[model samples]
Target: MRILLVEDNQALAEGLSTILRGSGYAVDAVADGASAEAVAAAEAYDLVILDLNLPEMDGLDVLRAMRARANKAAVMILTARGTPEERVKGLDLGADDYMIKPFDISEFEARIRVLLRRQAGLRSSIVNYGGVTFDLNSRTFSSQGVTLDLPAREVALLELLFLRAGKVVSKDAIMASLTGFDDDLSANAIEQYVSRLRRRLAPHGLTVKTARGIGYYLETTAPTA
Candidate 1:
């Protein structure tokens, strides 16, 4: 999932961004609330790690603006606000969760998992679409009750498609999800991956449908006449 981390501390921001990126999550970090607000407003992020004290605007103000603009991304306030009033204020401002500094990385990841699962209303680690099953934590995929041997990139593609099943996902979005910075990708390469996936998944009763000039969607099977 994509996340925007708003922390003014350089070291903290870099550390958190590294950890999230290493865990296969798309991460963007900003040291000030202005950049955070701009980035958050410009793009749709799955989560936001915000700090209370910012350079220009307060983190609470940022949260308020986000809510004002109707951005529903999960907001986790990461600050030194341990008092009841501070926490309550942040929560009242539409922050989904709160975390204090000096936090354990392991606990942070665990909380992130819980928050994401909670947001998705998914109690289980498994995501099922048609005959395709994915264990989100393990990064393993199975089809027709058998495991499928897929490259990491292919697996990423599958994850995106499965997550957005029954909805058309634009090719541009897919490219952005799969290709990180410093990686070059071509449109033809994406088509090739989709083609390969189609051939492999067809045997297991899953179809990745293309919408001509639009994008692609996942389905259980080809439509009947």
Candidate 2:
């Protein structure tokens, strides 16, 4: 998943970004609300972790602008604002979840998982497709109770394709969600990863279909002989 983290506190932002990336999320962080708004507008993100007290523009205004521009990424207000009015206003402006600062790290990550899953229209943490099962919490793929050990990038790719499921995900979209701002992966590299992932899934009755000039999508069922 890709996340846009908007926080003015450099220390907190770096810490959260590291944690999120370690958990298999591609995160781009901005220290101001204006940059947050611009970055969020330009990129496709699965979630936005926003801080209210921002330089130049307020986070609520950022949220408002995002919704105005029809950015459907799940927004989470992660700030020191703990008052009822602040929380209500953020939610009224389309924030999916709210968290006050000095919070528990475990709970913060858990909330993010729930919001992302909700954004993907998944009702549960466990996803099953074409005889393969994925546990979102454990971030593991299994088939018939056998756990498949995959490389980190492959795991991220699988989760991305699994979340989008039947939709054709473009190569640009895949690169954006899988690679960070400073990463140096190319389209050919992405194709290699996809090919490797395809082989890994084939034994489990899963197929990764390419859409000609577009991109790729996970087939919903096993291919017929």
Candidate 3:
């Protein structure tokens, strides 16, 4: 899933970004609320990790603005303040969850998982589509009784497609989900990966179809051979 992390602490931001990436999340991080707001407004994100204290604008103001604009992305507030009032204010401002500074990374990750699960309207970690099953925590995929080993990028790509199965996912969106802000690769790079996946999935009666001027779609019904 794609996430926007609004944090000012350089070290903490980097560390958290790394952790989220390792967990198969595409993360874009900014040190201030304004940049965060801009990016969040412009792009599609599954969630936001917002810090209450920010340069340019306070995180609460950011949350308020997002709500005013009807941005429905889930948000989790991260800050040094653990006071009841602060937590209440954040939730009232439409924050989905809250985390205090000096928190456990494991807990933070668990909370993120919960938020994403809720967003997807699922209560479990397993995502199943077209007879393929994915274990989110283990990052493993199984189809037709065969387990396939996928690299992290492939896993992320597959998850994105599966989440929006049958919908045309643009190359730009795939790039954003795969490489985030550090994408320097050609647009056709994603096509290469999709081609590889198509070959791999052919035996399972699934295929990735390119939509010419649009993007790609994953379909369960196979073409006539």
- Which candidate has the top score in lDDT? 2
lDDT of each: 0.83, 0.90, 0.84
Question: Each candidate's TM vs. the true structure?
Answer: 0.84, 0.94, 0.90
Best by TM-score: 2
lDDT tens digits by residue: candidate 1, 154-177: 787888888788999999888776
> Taking the candidates one at a time, how many backbone clashes does each contain?
0, 0, 0
Off by over 4 Å in 3: 144-146, 221-225
- What pairs collide in candidate 1? none
Clashes of 2: 0
True-structure Cα RMSD, model 3: 2.3
RMSD of each: 3.4, 2.0, 2.3
Better of 2 and 3 by lDDT: 2
Clashes of 3: 0
